[model samples]
Target: MEGGGGEQALSADNVRGIVLALISSGFIGGSFIIKKKGLRRAAAASGIGAGVGGHSYLLEPLWWVGMITMIVGEIANFVAYAFAPAVLVTPLGALSIIVSAVLAHFILKERLQALGVLGCVMCITGSMVIVIHAPQEQEIASVKEIWKLATQPSFLLYVALVIVMVSVLMFHFSPLWGQSNVLIYTAICSLMGSLSVMSVKALGTSLKLTFEGTNQLVYPETWFFVLVVSTCVLTQMNYLNKALDTFNTAIVSPIYYVMFTTLTILASIIMFKDWSGQSLGSITSEICGLIVVLSGTILLHVTKDYERIPQSKSIYAPLSPSLTTRLTGELLDHVEDGRASDEEKVLRRQEMF
Candidate 1:
């Protein structure tokens, strides 16, 4: 069937892609907390961290477990991208933010405020909207067809812009502000990630077609995509480790998700014209859905450090306004104290490095 301008019925392939994306989100979300625990353990043992160019996390078993889990999730994600449009597959990643936030609250001792809960709800609602209005996947018969799409002038311009920005971040801004600012490292990872995802989709399609009896391995474009995927993945992993080790998992996950998803969608629209046949209303809805998701993610990022003030009395017990104000003040002081302690420890470790 041709692509529709309205809500298209989910094909079998689309269903498979959705299921795999959900599973991938679960694994990826949990991996963030597990890996953070490992990073803390490694820093305690070696007096350094990935943020400060430390390599001790490689010796930590828990870190390896997290890495393996993420790899599995990414593999599933790769296949989903192959079968579905990026517009459909990319926004679904917001589910992982929910997973990460809940896990971080329980496991990492990061308190999720009431706003955080609302943020998670917004992410889910937005994801559902995108799923309902998602554009249909464009059909491509061979790896070369994907290559042709990728090499189009519009996509080439985007590729060029990404390269230039990445170069500036790596060579100039990174040296000056990378360690101090979370955005520096996360931006690098996100930019590289967008390109890597495109390469993954192409390579995945090649493998899928190959398994279906047509040989894509004979083409140089297939191998070229493999090379791009390899390089981009490595770059993303390196910088992402730095971001994760140096910052709160709650903050890193949502920011990375937002940036990566946005760029991947932009690249897909440029390269594949995924929105070509969509109705204006459907397109507007998808954009609104994306905005809601981004708003939720930003809420998560801003409120990740906030905790609900606990009350001494329960069962609808009344309290004076003065008492409530005192409790809230105490909570703020406690949170600030904990943040200061953590920062002090990181500074000491960086000095050692």
Candidate 2:
């Protein structure tokens, strides 16, 4: 009877993990597409409106809109992770590439080669397999408990300091922009997202403190954890963004999720001490899932080509005889009609040459 009950519990856990993974994957995939589009629009607006004075009111609105979208995405992500197994949740996030690819096809009109398509398929298959076959019945402690643990003064101070230091480094080094603009943009988006989550938490606490007459407002630990989580997320996102910049979104996104999922699972073991006393079969499944993830990542590099179409040479190259003659004639006519001055003609001629 006990054995049967254990088996049933395991099955239930497996199902939960799979469902969580799927939800996380879909949300993250959608978020990436939205973020990319928003960023592109913002960049264009900044370029067009920021003239010689380099000041534009348009920038504020665009930045805020992007920030809001990012915040919403992160909230969805956190909710999904809270319910699902970290391993399952993390790997499913890789579905962003699939989402990005589809969106890019319809919106950006970016052509996808056969290799890109194959890579996408491999990534999807591997990610699904990893999630579906993940070991079940792992115990997760309540978020409230985690929050309490994080609230300890020593731990709170340490996390707070770490987050501050990392934020400073990110701002000063601007690693993403220097190494890869896409990464920089993604990091900025993630930072905003993390802050948004922290803000939401603060608002909730404030309400509780105000209406319920609780003393939650005085807890520094609450803010400290918020900063820690946000910084950690931002740092991870930087690397993920860099990966996406070079590889097809389909390929890169899945791999990132896989990496994170694996990390989360490992962390769970070390930090939470969950999954203890698991059967050999369950352990094997976890190992096999990791192998599948590795295979998918390998397939991404194997089936992908990074060659870009060489841009056409400019139509307005250095002045040739024909162009020079045409410009000179136009200038001569303008001068003869008194539409321009002699100095203007000379200046125009010099410009053509």
lDDT per residue as tens, model 2, 166-194:
47646765553534433443333333333
Query: lDDT: which candidate is best?
Result: 1
10 residues in a row with least lDDT, candidate 2: 322-331
Candidate 2: regions farther than 4 A off: 1-24, 31-70, 136-224, 230-262, 294-353
- TM-scores for all candidates? 0.72, 0.50
Question: Considering every candidate listed, which one attains the maximal TM-score?
Answer: 1
**Candidate 2 residue pairs in backbone clash:** 94-253, 94-254, 97-249, 97-250
Q: How many backbone clashes does candidate 2 have?
A: 4
lDDT (C-alpha, whole model) for all candidates: 0.70, 0.41
- The C-alpha RMSD in Å for every predicted model, in order, reads 11.6, 15.6
